[model samples]
Target: MTIPTLEDSGQGTGTAGEARRLAVRGDLTMAHVGAIAGPLRAIPPAGHDLAIDLSGIDRIDTAGAWLIHRMVQDWGAAGVPARVENASPDADRLIAEVAANDRPVPCHVPRGNSALDQLVRIGNAVFVITENIGKILAFLGQTLIVLAQTLVGRRPLRWHAVIHQCEAIGVNALAIVGLLLFLVGIVVAQQGAVQLRQFGAEVFVVNLIGRGTFRELGLLLTAIMVAGRSASAFAAQIGSMKLNQEVDALETIGMSPIEVLVIPRVIAMAIMLLLLGFYGSVMAVIGGGLFCWVSLGIPPVSFIQRLQEATPLSDLVIGLVKAPVFGFIVALMGCYQGMQVTGNAESVGQRTTQAVVESIFIVIVLDAFFAVFFSALGYN
Candidate 1:
């Protein structure tokens, strides 16, 4: 039989300016001080007296003593009479430690071992900026190189790799994107219907569905999906390579790991994203059409016709254009994080998490850029 135990049993009470007693048990460690401080800080100034009954304290440490001293100083500063009662001999010895230190304590700062320290600090800062700038430049340069290689290959194009990438990015991801876009379409249509009915303009639901889904939802959903999928994949792949020393093996064999691994993954992702965008747009439109038919009595043919009339060719162009850029970013970010993976499983997990977060950030920022750019170009 198992029974749950109560965690805390301390009680405090009664009247202004009266001493309140606290029963502290278990280990008298720094962690214990933290727990005690939470309730102690909340006590009113009128009844600010605190007494720690440490008779139940089985083990005490230096951190516990330091905490007590700080608390005493704080109460003294606040004009609250704080006293220690029932301190064990060990606790008394710890309290004596602070009293015996008479000299003015120096501030806690460590001086470095000379010129190399300064050089190392400066070099580290420079190296960080240089490395980040280099990553952007390298990513762009590598992207262009990969695209050019695909476009102007003297040998036949590697249809096999491209096909595999398509399967990974597009086919495997279809269910998730479709389901989400369908839900998005339903929500957008429902919201549009409510407001449209107010103005007796429910027929315009078709326009809302077409413009919103085709132009924004399609691109946004595709980007978010790809970012999570590809960025995580990259981090995991690179982290595994780092952990298993596969990257080192490649270097030893005089092969560029970037050219071999990064390029293929990026290319695959880019191609897959574009296809996913197209697929998402179709699914969203279908979902919105279903909503229109059910809620607004609009037939599918009329909805399509309304979408054709309300959404311009340029909107389609804008949506399609965002996909490739989003794809490139997703792929690049994944590869970058993968390459940045460190030597341990924990580090791999950390970098993978970082990659997902960073990729999503980059995607949103770039989407804002595209939104502004297209607006300026009269394409929105």
Candidate 2:
């Protein structure tokens, strides 16, 4: 077989100067295409049209055709018209196919009006947010339907999965939740005592601790912790299952992925957050009481008496009422983001981060709304 070679045909000097020509000789297969590719691309733009002669090619393949098509495209892009000439039927067909498959990269042109561009970007962002909110609402409806079915005995509750998730979400998280709330309680008591001591009312620090812990800190902080820990875990687990097509496999076996996967997680989060929230409140109160005993010289008994008198049943009720709702929001956002994952590992990571962020944001927003609502009802 002849070795592949690219030879430059001398430029014509006629009145109408002919285009420069590059003739490719020998087998233009994968094995030889690489050798000739460099020289072909090195041909200078002599301020004339360009022609690639392929008739001298002993054999040709897709690789060679691609090389020829790329050379023509490169020259054309440089304002030098280029074409293939004297190609055999097979070579011509292959080159044509390669050329047809070459797609130009899109160029982004800046708009003249900066304000208009900004407005367009803002509109697109708003559209994406609205679309995502719609999707989340639809997911919420589907989950509710599945939950209702389970409640009515139409769908079987997966007790095993629920128990597993409860252990993972609540039991495993107990230490961190208790520690954080305890520290926060001590800080709040110290700060409150400092302020109240100015007016010789340092004893009222108990009221600050009790009311704050039961009404807001305990449940709100616990929910945020759970959102960071359990929400990200849920998104990662479900997203991985999706990437592996295990979700599809369940569907193939006539199992509803939502019923099997989502319901158990949601139920477990609701149940466990209730318990965790109460436990966290007790821990915070204990920390505050300890701080008062050591720093403010208020004995435990005195602190307890003041706490009872100052923190009402209404405050406790408000916190408990918010727990399960916050839990549901966390679980729903995680699962929704998980279900949205597609493509690859990067997508799973993105969804997991989104789940954590969205869960915490929604939880805080709802907490604010609940605070306003209860205040209107005279719970403050």
The most accurate candidate by TM-score is: 2
Model 2 C-alpha lDDT per residue in residues 13-131, reported as the tens digit of each score: 43355877788899999987889888876776655688888878899999988988888888888887888999988888888888888887759874589999899999999999999
> For model 2, what is the error of residue 45's alpha carbon versus the real structure, in angstroms, after optimal superposition?
18
Model 2 score (lDDT)? 0.92
Across 1-380, the per-residue lDDT of candidate 1 in tens digits comes to: 11111122233354574566656566757655566656655654434476656676777778767666666667767886677779898798997796566357669887878898989999999998698768877877865776676568732345676677678778889999999888888888999999989999998888888888778888788789877876887788887997899998998998667666776777787777877887898888899899999878999888988899999988888888888888877877777777777767888888788788877888888888888998998886
Error of 1 at 153 (Å): 2.8
Q: What's the lDDT for residue 215 in model 1?
A: 82
Q: Quote the positional error of residue 38 for candidate 2 in Å.
A: 18
Clashes of each: 0, 0
